[model samples]
Target: MDDQHLHDHRRLGRELGLFDTDPLMGAGLPYWLPDGAVVRHQLEEYVRELECSAGYRHVYSPVLGKRELYEISGHWAHYGDDMFPPMRLGGGGEEVVLRPSLCPHHALIYRSRSHSYRELPLRIAELGGMYRSELSGALGGLTRVRAIQLNDAHIFCTLDQAVEEARAALALIARAYADLGIRASRHRLSLPGDGAKYVADPALWRRATALLREVLDGSGIAYDAVEGEAAFYGPKIDVQIVDPAGREATLSTVQIDFHQPERFDLNYIGPDGAKHRPVMVHRSVVGSVERAVAQLVEQHGGAFPAWLAPVQLAVLPVSEAQERQAHDLAERARARGLRAEVAAEGSLGARIRAARLVPYQVVIGEREADAGLVAVRLRDGRRVDPLPSAELLHRVTARVGARGTELWADA
Candidate 1:
């Protein structure tokens, strides 16, 4: 990696006070600091808004499930090696396990109620937690972890609707990537290879793989078809991203699953008032919140986009005389929904250096405060001409609200 892209997220994460893992907390279980929580909360809110606008209903499911649940979903048979051992509640009591994926619970949710053809493309979304029994060697920063909060969703639809639903999911992922300043390295069609790791039904595998290929082709997305990369349940189109070290990892995916519906006996009423099976389309905009944030930390080199930055605006006072003005500016920013704080303890140069990564810095000096004006410093090191505090605040609020990639709206 070149010096320009040499910043590692683990290093930046610690320096920026974003997240940390401790021996007491165990590896792969990092806790978010206050600043990190703010960034994560904003990212999650953006996803929820996007999903809700696209006709997806948010849902909440338990992190733990009965052992029979995974067995029915075939995770116990096909993916047990990666799953934690089941927990027996008490002496000779029923066993439960931390869910390895949200798909099984979602399948059960779909089976809970009878649906009609009008509701064929029922989209259910969740920012839910799942666990993986990752080997100690594989565990690192947020990129690889045992506990993951996935941005998962499933669409229950007729076979004919599966391709379109998957395509729409790909579109959503692209839109999210653009907003987050993430670039896709490539798209991959992940299929089953010669092995017993997948479901036994060859016909189902062929059909599902064809559907995903159609989705990619129809969306005008060129993809590399790779075998042995598909999930145990079905085939998928994976969106890959390159890290600073030039390694590829999946950032998002759209999968077509036919096995789970059959295993769970999921059904809906057809237009003719007869029972029919609905295909399950599994997709994630950003695979895992922690991993996504880690990628962002590296991508931006700890200076995130305005709306996603932990502290959008830092108010700096030149001296004690302007301290009150600086705080007032911060309050105004907070009122407009931008994360802002005052830095009044250190010298003006020291405070500015400390807040260099902040998206915007408002420097209040005695002259500027007396004239009701403030000098704005952007993340890119550009200092704007003095402008009225209200005007600067207005432009900043507009830029942040729009989530524009530029540091300043005018720029």
Candidate 2:
């Protein structure tokens, strides 16, 4: 089969019951099916764990903000075309709009309390929702959506620490991609070209651009420097990925900004007991959960690794005689936090074919059930010697816990 036919996420997603779009939901809005939700939830949890270990403090913020907030952040000036229009109460009351980005709110959070030099580097993270008024023609599947759940974080640190923070963020991104089996097509140093779209401060732009260059060079990662692709306020390092059609899109980013700190007047007390502005570093390990899942769906061709498979295991009974045993095994697997279900409505062969994409399938026949064992079938079509049900579950659980890419760690 051709590459596009084999790896198209839109087709694979629908066939696997991952996600679907409906007319009533509007264009650019797609609903996640149960299986898709499971995948998204797992990815979100993984990101939270990764960020927590790296000293990021997660927070919750409102999705809607006053119009004045975006205006202050310069989003209204530079990004108004892609933002949803403001909604207001009757008779010129308070007007609000869905936030196009989380940076403004995070900036507000930092300014909420005074900080000392010792706390100069404050890493704030959120699995937050934001909206964009995308054009109808630009919408397709989860790749381009109006509502986005972004795994976004912003770091407030001194100028001297910004490069190191950006580097750490890049390393975290690399770790996540390796675990997920996603690859970077390229690393792009996105700068602001001679365009009216960017904030017009030549000195600030030059400084931020130089800092991002330092980050990429220090990491020893080769990258292409592209112009006219930067954020309105600053330059960034964009980790790019290609789709099944060979179209390139950014999957992750690390950006450095001095503009937002000035706009929000964010400051921390220095060693001399004086207020000083802090630099803002924006980064995302996974840009959008929807897009990330889409990439995974194609990258793995809907046969995800053991830990990421929507249905990790299928328990099949040879006949009615072994049905009870199948249920017992499934229950034990679930109790151990595995995604498992008993498939007994059909012949064992038919059930096995149906669960081809599942990472593991265990069959219980009269002989196996009588011996309290299971006939294990790996997804790659390898058969393992019959083993005690308890032992099989133990090995599978350990493999899943470790997020091993191989079907069997020992193998």
Candidate 3:
């Protein structure tokens, strides 16, 4: 692997002050600066919009769960090693663990309600923070961290609806990747492994694998089959994307589980009046927010799209005499819902240079301010013709809503 690209990203991240890691505070934990937080908030908003449009209801669950909860979910036996050590409170008896996933909590929520066949498919989504203990050496900027914000969701559906739900999940992931400018190569279908490591039911594994393959084929998506990658309880499909460094990362995944419902005794009254277990599908469009942000930064070389740019426009006054106008123009831009700011304490050239370093779309100037307009400049250093304040507002607002790259285009 060439160190050039890797070093480039690390230098850019530090120079932009997006995030920082301090050994004293412990490794694998990143402290995000205000600029970094802005990027995250934009990502959260984007994911929320996607989930809402796909008919998933937003939900939240606690970060820590009791030890018994994990035992019942089979996480204690299967994923205990990946989890942070339990905290023993009140001396010794009770133990709590930071949640590694949201599936168990969502399952408990489903069990809390009694549902009929009419409500067979229930989808819940969350943008929640999750934690896992990682070796210090494994920690990197935003890509590999101990604490991460996950864009997670769970769907509980009848066997008859499982395939459709899976298709829907795939569609959601594809659309999200397109929006983020990520290109999908091929899907990876993870099936149950060998007899020793998997449930001793060959018939069931074969049936599930066949079902997943059928679904993938019918959806017209090319995929490769891989054994031993599925969760102990079920088969899964992972969307792989190649990063700037040519490494494949599982950007999103959808898993179908027929076993978890049985483990948790989750059932719904069927159309025929008998109680039956509903298949559970766990998915995430952008698997981990930290990794997603890192990918976005590298993909665009740190020049984010307008909607995701921490500061969409930077207002620069040519001299101190133009400060009031710069502030006024910034206020107007902000009122129009664009993230705009005035650079009041730097040389005009220095201010514009600094603004270009970040992912802002335009740099306003004194000449346009005198005409009640703002001069615009693209991040790539191209100058846009001056536009009236109202016109600029409308243009910026439109680009933001559409999440278009043309937002930085010359007027």
Candidate 4:
């Protein structure tokens, strides 16, 4: 990793006032500003659309849960070190821990209802906030934070349906990354080796690892076998991306788990009317929204694409005389579902510079205003001749709605 590139991103995020970390409140915990919250909401909306299209049901769960819950799900033994210490109530009673993952909570919900084979392929998703105790030294910007919102989902499928379900999850992940202008490398099917990191049961590990290889081989997606990266309970296929600075990060992951259901004593009636444990697949297309946003900020140098840009259009009036006109233009753009804003206070040149700093496509001025058109410049240095505001709106709306890169090009 280039230390300078990472440093540059930290500088940009701080300069933009998006987020901050304080040593007093503890490291790894970030406080998001209003502007940062807007970017987060935009990312959530995008993920929600993707999940809905992929047939995943959205649900909400509590951020804190009883101690026994994680204990039952094996997270206490497997993930306890990464979790915050339990909170003790005033009365002598059980303790609670802030949730580190949504799976255990979602699993409880599934077990609440006695499921049949008909609901075998149940996929529950949540854009849930989670907490972990990260080493203070590891915390930096939004990339490594104590509080994180994960695009998480868990799929409960029968043994026969495991491969198909895994493929569908992979497809959803691929489509999401592609749409967001993120390039994912070929999948890496991670298997457990005869190492301390893996489970001791060689037979069970072999079987679970083979299932992943079979699925990848059948799907015809090129993948390399990575040793010693499997989750404690099962094997996983990780979708990784090397960032602009050449640091490889796991962007998404799909794990096929066989042991968790058995450990939790989860069961469903199968087609043969026999009680069977459904296999669990834990997957996330975009690992963490905070991390993804950080990557995007560096990837595009904070000049986000129209669909993801916090402020899509920055309206600038040439002089005080055109201020009202600028405000009017901003309202019009907002009315058409674009995120448009007028410069609060500054010279025309200063306002344009400030606007450009936050990633916007068009900067309108008096010449185009007098001509009944809007002046537009793209991030890539392309200049477009002024066109009528309504026409410009149509073009922009189409591009934003379609999530097209050409809009950036055409501008």
lDDT of 1 by residue, 163-255 (tens): 899999999999899889988999999988877788888899899988887898899999999989999988888999877877789989999
Whole-structure CA lDDT of model 2: 0.93
Q: For candidate 2, what is the total of clashing residue pairs?
A: 0
Estimate every model's Cα lDDT from 0 to 1. Answer: 0.91, 0.93, 0.79, 0.79
- The candidate that wins on TM-score is 2
Model 2 ranges with Cα > 4 A deviation: none
- Quote the positional error of residue 25 for candidate 1 in Å: 1.5
Task: Single out the weakest 10-residue window by summed lDDT for candidate 2.
Answer: 402-411
Q: Please give the lDDT score at residue 51 for candidate 2.
A: 98
lDDT tens string, model 3, 26-139?
888878888888988888999998899888999999999998888887777776777898888897689999997788889999999998889868998999888888877877
User: On residues 250-356, what C-alpha lDDT tens digit does candidate 2 reach at each position?
Assistant: 99999999999999998999999999999999999999998999999998888887888899989999999999889999999999999999998866778989999
Residue by residue across 1-411, what tens digits does model 4's lDDT show?
A: 455465355667777777777778777777777777777787789888888888889999999998998887667877788899999877988799999888888888788889999987999899999998888788777788889889999999988888888888888877777667777756898877674444466676777777778777877889988887777667899987765557677778888887767767889998798999988888898989888877767776677667877788887777787777778888988999998888858777777677774434455566776777777766556777877778777877888887644454354
Compute the lDDT for candidate 4: 0.79
Q: Weakest 10 consecutive residues, lDDT, candidate 4?
A: 402-411
Better of 1 and 2 by TM-score: 2
Question: Sorted by lDDT, highest first, which candidate order results?
Answer: 2, 1, 3, 4
Candidate 1: C-alpha lDDT? 0.91
